[model samples]
Target: MSHKRSFVRRTAAVVAAGAAAFVLAACGGDGNGDGSAGHGGHNATASPSASASASQGQHNAADVAFAKGMIPHHRQAVEMAGLAPGRAQSAEVKKLAADIKKAQDPEIRTLSGWLTSWGEEVPAEGAMDHSVHGMGGMMTDEEMTELENASGKAFDTAFMELMIKHHEGAVEMAKTEQADGAHGPATKLAGEIITSQSAEIERMNELLGKD
Candidate 1:
């Protein structure tokens, strides 16, 4: 009887945990009000396609590639940005984080608009293989593990380093899309990512050097 009770308790605990996870995910992320995540966490946003695909104007293979490639790419950027306020050490780091969130959130809304207009599913949730797009600066599983385990200043430093590289990779990919992509709105956003992230990279480098 005791063994059976123990099993029941464990099952109940697991169910509760899962329910909590779902709630947190639905709340957009379990970040602090300051807009930063603690260690390692995924973020969810309203589907960019949910509202804007119908008005996407014209599109082709390149447009599709830009959207497909960029959904995961942008997802990572939002993740990194969301990680900034809590994990970074310097004020500059926090500002960059704020800038990233501010910049990307609306862009997310805009992309959703594009997706809605195009009638494509917003490509937010997926196990995207970075190699398919030739992006190499992505976080390794182990690196992500370390970031998850880190705290305080260590968290800040590591987060900054990883995010800087992440932003650089994004800039490269965005430039490629800007030059070669077919979607009007997406390509415009790609250009913006290149310009914005490039400037941010310079800022991050200066912060890191101080660190």
Candidate 2:
């Protein structure tokens, strides 16, 4: 009876030690000393995806439309600007065209990038006919063709007038964005466009010697 009791006591001691060792090993591996890794890891992994989802979701339809529409509009402006270097006669006209190209080219890329990041469709060059876009102040196809064919002082005059109208259209779009857009960067760009192009519009009018 005494021998059997000794064997039982030793076996129970070994079992307890083994259990304690297992618990310690698990705690060391988990690093938290708590049985929380499973839940904690799942939450941590899900956080970034949730954040990205929320960020992408913040933009509204107006924001998407603005980015899509502005790209082609800015492209047409750049195309018009490219004509001025060789065809325009006035120094001021040439400089203004260069400035427009320099400023708006990067903005086109910026808008395109934003649209792409948002999973929205980006408008390519010639994506829409300006005349049919129903956008304010966009030049007609005939108007663009006429400007392209013009040269010397005629080119300068046509470029300025067309650009003024184009900038006006951009301002209108930007104003809409400012009022209705939900994306922060897009709204900020809209405000900058309003300020910059409004000034440019005034300058172009001054160049044309018009009120």
Candidate 3:
């Protein structure tokens, strides 16, 4: 009977040791963070999809319209900004272009994402007739062409002159968004643009000494 009891004790000890080994092997050395394997790589790493999910916004129909409209608006501003680096001489005018490009470029991406998530077409990419989109200010093709053809100190002066007009137009468009835009993000961006460009217009006027 003593020998029989000893055999049972040995079997129990072996079983407990095996179970502990199995747990340790499954748990990776110290996946105390999670029950993943000791390899540490078994834990779920964050993906771009996860990051994007966190940043994704809940856009309204107004937001969709705003993105649709504002994308073209921002694109035009970027195109306008491009002229200064090549044609203008004033540090002030160049800075204005830089500011517009920096601000609007990211905003464009944001708007694009909103549109994509909504399963909508990117608005400005349409065969858009800008005449219908003329919310407030836009230079005629003739004026833009003339600006493009200019050179020297004249280029700087003309660029500033053109941008002030451009900025005024943007202010008007922003106001329209504040009044009529559907989405909060787009409306908010419109308000921001109005505030920023209005200030820029004032600064440019000081630099150019416009009456």
Candidate 4:
């Protein structure tokens, strides 16, 4: 009876050990599964954020050129527009100048911001003095001075003419950006510039009786 009881006790111990081992194996399997699932979830969350950042930050040489060139170009347009409030005689010319100033000032800020984010140099406040000569349709120092000196109808006519030329240059630059730039926001802005300035050019031509 003693030997039989001892064998029974031994058998029970073996069974208990087996049950514990099975439980441990099951727990280990669950832990590994949860860990892998957690890792996958983390990656899923990170991917879209990374992609969005990359998309926004993407830029090329043409985008840099567009921002750098447009900043000073916009500044010149704003400066030209500034002269109209005091010098222009026609209400329509004054309104056009005001609209030009309002539009281009924000664009200058935006272009500067792009340059800053891209780790490129923002054009200086005085850059138009030297930079204007290289860009298309930019008025010379002499021409700006002449516009500054003139008032009344002569100022109106001159403003319309010069601004028309300036808008043409901007349109050309924007078209180039549309064709070559890789930055999304910059390209979108280039499109907007093309549309708005093209319309303004038509209006200016009409104002000058050239259309």
**Number of the top candidate by lDDT?**
4
List model 3 lDDT by residue over 1-211, tens digit each.
Answer: 9999999999999999999998887676456646543224443354544555554434455556667767776776787788888887777678888998999899889889878878999865532365534454556667668878886578777777777877787777677667865566777888888888888888878987842
**Pick by TM-score: which candidate is best?**
4
Estimated TM-score for each candidate:
0.63, 0.71, 0.62, 0.73
Ranking by lDDT: 4, 2, 3, 1
lDDT per residue for candidate 2 within 1-211, as digits (tens), equals 9999999999999999999999888878777633354457766767888887786667888999898888888888888899888899988888899999999999999999988887877776677564435576666778878998999988988888888889999999999999998888899999999999999899999989942
lDDT of 4 at 162: 91
C-alpha lDDT values of all predictions: 0.71, 0.85, 0.73, 0.89
Better of 3 and 4 by TM-score: 4
- List candidate 2 segments past 4 Å from native: 1-57, 130-134
- For candidate 4, the per-residue lDDT at 179 reads 96
Clashes of 2: 0
Candidate 2: clashing pairs of residues = none
Error of 3 at 101 (Å): 1.2
Better of 2 and 4 by TM-score: 4
Ranking by TM-score: 4, 2, 1, 3
> What C-alpha lDDT does candidate 4 achieve relative to the native structure?
0.89
lDDT for position 33 in model 4: 77
RMSD of 1: 27.9
